[model samples]
Target: MSQTVSDFIVQRLHQWGVRHIFGYPGDGINGVFGAMNRAQGKEGEIGFVQARHEEMAAFMASAYAKFSGQLGVCIATSGPGASHLITGLYDALLDHQPVLAIVGQQARNALGGHYQQEIDLLSMFKDVAGAYVMQASSPAQVRHLIDRAVRIALARRAPTVIILPNDLQEEPYESPPRAHGTLHSGIGYSAPSIMPREADLDRAAEVLNAGKKVAMLVGAGALGATDEVIAVADRLSAGCAKALLGKAALPDDLPWVTGSIGLLGTEPSYNMMMECDTLLMVGSAFPYAEFLPKEGAARGVQIDIDAGMMSIRFPMEVGLVGDAAETLRALLPRLKPKSDGAWRQSIEADVATWWKTLDGRAHQPAAPVNPQLVAWELSPRLPDRAIITSDSGSCANWFARDLKMRRGMTASLSGGLASMGAAVPYALAAKYAHPDRPVIALVGDGAMQMNNMAELITAAKYWRSWRDPRFVVCVFNNEDLNQVTWEQRIINGDPKFEASQRIPDVSYSRFAELIGLRGIFVDTPQLLGSAWEQALASEMPVVLEVKTDPEVPPLPPHITLQQAKNFSLALLKGDPNESGMIKGAARQVLETILPGKQ
Candidate 1:
């Protein structure tokens, strides 16, 4: 073939530094796959990762962008394959990860007749595509559409979609200025440094400085700006609380920093939100308005790159529209250090006490295993550069609270979408992005069996690609949808329904072995460390299955009377896991009500 549209697409992707494309091959996308095969040389090589499912491909792509800070790319065929990508695409879109999705459509001639594998991809992708959603009508539109899609994804930091009809993929570029000019080179762009106006910064600083007790909420938009955020926090004497997505933005070891906010929150964060006189929201649009101070309870200064996100979460006295780091830098100079350290010290004391309480809870022995202790063991053992991904469930609660993130370590989950089955793909993408760094996936048993457990094979297939393979899958084999079970008992006021939340017991370690990867099974607390060591030593992907107690509830830092009432009802209804629920309630009461006395 003499330089088809498919060839140009691959070539442009290479130029833009997209080293990998995650997707499954299908008949509708055969033309693109064929062109991908023909591309050669160092720059021409865009690794096409063959995921078992299109959903997994989309997740891998989303995580690739998240970990590497690059534009992640995924492709799929028309109809079902394309539809399968929606959830993952939504995950990326809602979480604000830069992703480019290319979906194959039926040939132009058969598009409207509802041919086999035919779907109007543009219509299907409209909602999740963020802004750039277009079809490559002809070969001439291919390069332009691809360029715009990439630009939109990068500049907007959201997903963009390009629908390629099967016939369009094979069409030759005939209307370009020149063949080589059309398939351009040296295409690069830089994000403009966004800083708030001087007056806005001064006003924000004034509002921040005026308050006696300040609390700052940070998010992923403040990534790599840890110093600026901390500087502002220090200047304002603010207790900082990270939104779940910004869990790794600040080291958990920081005395002034509270790990996370909302339901999966720390006592310090909860108390700080309730007590703050001023709130400075740095790049976080944390959706839980209920977790924030009541309107007019605190004066707020909100800073965000997107003007739309500022002041949306909380009532703002000063809304600074700019980049988080830049705005913070400007505000820091204008802010005066607080005279009273008592407010900061009080929050610090609460944080210290909370940790001690958590340590007591995590280490306490259980029948199968203590889930919190498992996370604690893994946290200290993780390499400084380890990239951790957790499935959304009770596993997230453990990982969020117990997993102590350091300066270099990074962790993420489906924060915005709160979806499961993403941990495996996220880990794979992190490994693909930085093969030298250790990548670990913390998944609950419920999430492990969801749809794409087959993607573990993808990790096995690509094991040798890494020079030092240190990918480990830590499965919390509690044999139930523990998070949802807890939710059912506490939120919905129902006894544990075995059929809905209970999971069939699976030997995840054996499954790993069967898939041609190393497996480490841990049923006892004592074996956890050894299993982790063995996993780290293995030069291939290792799945460490930790059989934990399904009964041990993943309790929140603060418990409400409503939650307690629901649990009591469940216990009265002869809930099989009654002991755990009772114990969880007792612990919450002891921790919250009897803090220092306990």
Candidate 2:
């Protein structure tokens, strides 16, 4: 029997260093699976992971790329199977991660004839991968298409697609594959550092030197330049405020480091931005322009590798288009150290007071578990090298504010898209990338039920393959969309409609057990520690379902008068859920306005 096109595709993937393929079996892609079976026992052969759905497969693939810094690959059959991969593919594209998706099409002759399970997969994926979507029209084009898709995804940090027709996949290959140079194994397709122009560097320094008070806003792009960023901040004697995505960039223990700077932010960060006369933004294109300094209130100097993102959020006085570390290094030599440390000292003092205040709130005793306390108790218990993922909702707020990310720990969230149901996939991918380390996911009941609960079975299926069985999923059973409900009350001046915002009761821990995994449930604060210990000690995947108080609102660092007015209107609307709203407001207002805590 002669080799088929599917065989060549698998060979090309092996040469490019793919170790895992996340997908589900289907008739449209039966030929590809046949080739996979034939290549068993070969060196560098890929392992197949069976997912409950194609969307979960795509999410896992994207997260694999994020944690491992490798080209993540996903496979799906034609028609609806391929359509299900769109949302997760967008997740990768929005986060700027590299992912390659291979979807099966109908037989070559039935492509446009509306045959069974037939659809134009190319046109469907055009929006996501307009530049990189290709079809293997002939057997000779199989190898080249695979190579091009992988290279484009790696170099550009974007998603690429390859459509394989069912008929062509089983055809005999007539020509030899073109020989291409081996890919570099070190950093996998990273470009050289881009240095900024001397003139732009000088102008940035001039703006900083002219100001009496300065502040630096850091983002994820500055992760590699942590040391350089600290050096520049120390030289300028500037306070550092981190964007939510940059939460783990620097240690929170740093005296001058103010925490996150948006809705899920701290008072110190908000105050630092309000007082600074000059802002130095490094590798951060943080949205929410209202949180930033108003026009003419502060002079701005921005640094980013993508020139297109320059001045997109706030107007910059000097935009230095270059790599973060290199630009900071160039600007350091021409800058002068601030003669006064008073500004930085004051900011540090405020940050210390905020921590004490947060601790007091997190430890408050209540009927049900307080969400903030969950983060507080779990933070000290995690291993130094643990990987954590958070779902978007009120749970994310607690994780952002109360959780402490040390120097060695890594955490991820959907910062740009703010999507729910990513925690399950994120944790699975992290465990696959570093099987020896612990992986945890902090999710809400509302988010857990939203297309991610089924993923628990997927985790159970792959449990035996992991070297370390320290995977934990902490479920916050709040029974409501607490984040958006609070937003409706505070932003829209609308009362919470119980029917619409409430989530039906479901025991997530029981669901875990039914899927053949360890499960623990806690309804009170006293059992929080014991539940976590049990999870860590179990030599298998565990889900800890903690019944949390939905009444405790995740308040922002600062609130305007208009927001207060909206809450008052909700109270006057005579809704039955007004007491929780009133209590949350009182707690936040009293703590912020009263001076005794300081």
lDDT of 2 by residue, 452-557 (tens): 6888988998888899988999999988988988998889988988888998989999999999998899998988987888887789999999999887878888
Model 2 bad stretches (over 4 Å): 174-190, 594-598
Candidate 1 structure quality by residue, lDDT tens digits, 96-195: 8889998888999887896998777888899999589998777776767877889889999899998888888888855455656465423666889988
Give the C-alpha miss distance for residue 577 in model 1, angstroms. 2.6
Q: Which residue runs does candidate 1 get wrong by more than 4 Å?
A: 177-186, 587-598
Return the lDDT, model 1, position 353: 81
What clash pairs does model 2 have? none
Model number with the top TM-score: 1
Provide the overall lDDT of each model, using Cα atoms, as 2-decimal numbers. Answer: 0.85, 0.84
User: Whose lDDT is greatest here?
Assistant: 1
